[model samples]
Target: MLKKITLVVATTLLVTACGSNSETAGSGSADSGQSDKVYKLKLAATWGPTLTPFIDASQNMAKMAEEMSNGRLKIQVDPSNKHKSPLGILDLVKSGQYDMGHTATYYYKGKDLATIPFTAMPFGMTSTEQQGWMYYGGGLELMQKVFKPHNIVAFPGGNTGMQMGGWFKKEINTVDDFKGLKMRIPGFAGEVIAETGAVPTTIPGGELYTALDRGTIDALEWVGPSMDIKMGFHKIAPYYYTGWHEPGAELHYLVNDKAYDKLPADLQQILKTAMRVSADDMSVRTQHMNAEFLAQMKTEAPNVQIKTMPPAVLNELKAINDRLVGDMVNESPMMKEIIESQQAYQTKARNWGKLADYQYIKDNQ
Candidate 1:
C-alpha cells in the first residue's frame, strides 16, 4: 500500500510540472502577440488652432498613424503659439526638442537657400503641379538629401494654394508704389521684393493683424481669402491684391531623422501615408474655404477692393525673381541640382497645364 501511495504522489507531481510548463509556453506566446511596439512622438505647428482646415488635416494624419500601427504608435500634436515663429520651429525639431514641426520652407532660407525650392517660387507650379513634382519628379529625393545633414526629414504637409497678392494701404498702380513699402514677406519672395525697393520683414502670423491695425507695416501678405478674412485684414487694409506671385505656397513638416528611423517599419509607412493625405486635405480645404470667404468678403466688406498687380509691376517682379533664383543656383551645388530638376519638371508640367488648365480657364472666362 505504501508503494502504491508513493507511485500516485510521484504521478501527481509530474502532472503538475507538465501543466506549469504548458502555462508558461502559453503565457510567452500571449505576451509576444500583444503588439509590435509603441513610439510616442510630438508634432508642433506654428499655425493656430483656428486654422481649422490645416488643423483638421493634421489631426487626420495622427488618426491614420494610430490606426495603421494598430495603436502601437501615438502622435501627440501640440497647440501652436504663433509667438514661437514658424522659422524657429524647424531648428527646434532638428535639435530633438520636438519630434516634428510644421512650417513654411522659405522661412528657413537663412539656414539653406535650397529651402526655397521646397516652398513655392514666383510663378511656380500650382498646388497640384507642385505635389506632382515633389512626389514623382525626384523633388522628394532632393529635399531629403538637403535636409539629411541637418538631422531632419522634411515632408510637404500643406499648400496655401495661390495666395492673394497682398493687402496694401494704398493702390499699387505703378512699380514706384513698391518703393519704401514696409511689407511682411519672407524667404525668396522677400529677396525679390527687396529688389523692388520694398522693405521685407519676417513677421509672425499672429502679429500681422496688430501690425496692420497700428500701421506698423504699410502692407502685408498672408495666405489667401480664408486666412485673410479670419485675420480681419479687410478692416485695416482696404486694397486686397491677387496672389499671383506666390502661386502655390507649400508648407513642410520637419521630422527628426533619428527619431523617424527609430520607428518600426510599419510605423514609418503609416507616417508617409498620413503626410500624403494631409497634403491633399490641406489643398482641398484651402480651395473650398477661399471660395466661400471670397463670397463673404464681397457682401461684408464692400470697401475692400480686389485688384491685380499692375502689368509693369508683375513683369518687373518676375524679372527680379529670375535673378534671385539664378544667384541661388550659382551659390550652392545642391541649389543647382534642385533648380535644374524643378525647371525640367516645370517645363514638362507647364505644357500639360497650358493644354488643359489654361484652355479650360480661358474658354470658361
Candidate 2:
C-alpha cells in the first residue's frame, strides 16, 4: 500500500513540471516574435557625407527615428557618392528605388514649375516668416498639393536663414557686368538672373567648387559663410555678394508615399516628429555656425570683400523677377494659387515682422 501511494505522487509531480515548461516555452516564443520584426528603410541624400548641417539634418533625423521607435525602424542614409544622383534625388525616391530623399525642392523646377516657391523665392519671406507660413499659413498644404502628383510627401528638412548672393570672380558694379557672364544659381532666382543676359546653370553641390575653380563657371551662389568657408570659396573668389535671391533657403525631405503609409501609425508619428525636431536643430546649428564663421572670415580673410549690388542693379533684377513670376502665374493656375498664398502671408507676416524684429534690430544697432 505504501509503494503504490509513492508512485502516484511521482506521476503527479512529473505532469505538473511538463506543463510549466510548455507554458514557459510558448510565452518566450510569442514575445520574441513580437519584438523581432523590424522595418528597414533607405534614404538618398543630395549632399555628400561631409556636408555639414545639410548632411547633419538627415543623419540626426535617422538617429532620432531609430531611438524613438526603439529599434523597430531603421533608416540607412546614402550620400551622393553612393547614390550617384545628386540632382535626381526626387526621381530616385519617387520611383521607390529609395524610400526617401533629402534635397532642395527648387532643384526640381524643371520637373514642375510649381515646386519653386516651396523653397526660398527671390526676395521671399525670411527664415522665421517662412517657417511660420509653412507650419501655420497653409504653405505646407500647398507644398503637399504640388508634390502629390509625384507620389511624394514632402517635409521641411533644414533652412539656411539668408543665403549670400554668390561668390564672384569679378566685382559686379553695373547691369552690363552680368552680360555674357555664366553663373551657377538655381530656381526662380536663376531665371531672374537669366533676364539680365547672364547664363545661369545648376551644378551639383559636389561639383560646384571644381566648376568654379576650373573656370567652367564664372561664379556660384552657395550658402553663406558657414558652408562657404569649408568649401574654400573665399580663397578663390574675392567678391562675396549679399543675398537677394534666397532670403531663407529651405531644403526638403521627400518620402515615398507608399513607404510612408506602410509604417505603423505610431512609427509614422515618430518619423514626422524626428524630421521636425531635426530640421529645427539644423536651423539653429546653422545660425550658430554662420555667426562664428562670418566673424572668422572677417578677421582671417581680409581679401574677401563683402559686397551688395547697386540700387539700380538690384531694381533691374527685382523688375525681372516680378515679370517672370507673373509669366509663370499665367502659365499655371496652380502657380498662381501658390504665389498668391505666399504673397498674402508675406504681407501679413512682414507687417508684424517689421515691428517685432526689423524695428528691434534697427533700434538696438
lDDT of 2 by residue, 1-365 (tens): 99556534543453343243221111121123345568789999999999998998999889878876789889999999999999999899999999999999999998999989988999898999898888778877788889889989888888999999999999999999999889999999999989889999999888988989999989999999999988988878999999999999889999888888777655666677677777877898899999999999988899999999999999999999999889999999999999999999999999999989899999999
So what's the TM-score on candidate 2? Answer: 0.90
lDDT of 2 at 298: 89
Per lDDT, the best of the predicted structures is: 2
Badly placed stretches (over 4 Å) of model 1 are 1-36, 82-85
Q: CA lDDT of 95 in candidate 1?
A: 90
Over 134-199, each residue of candidate 1 has an lDDT whose tens digit, in order, gives 877887788888888888888888888888888998999888888999999887788888997889
lDDT of 1: 0.79
- How close is every model to the real structure, measured as TM-score? 0.88, 0.90
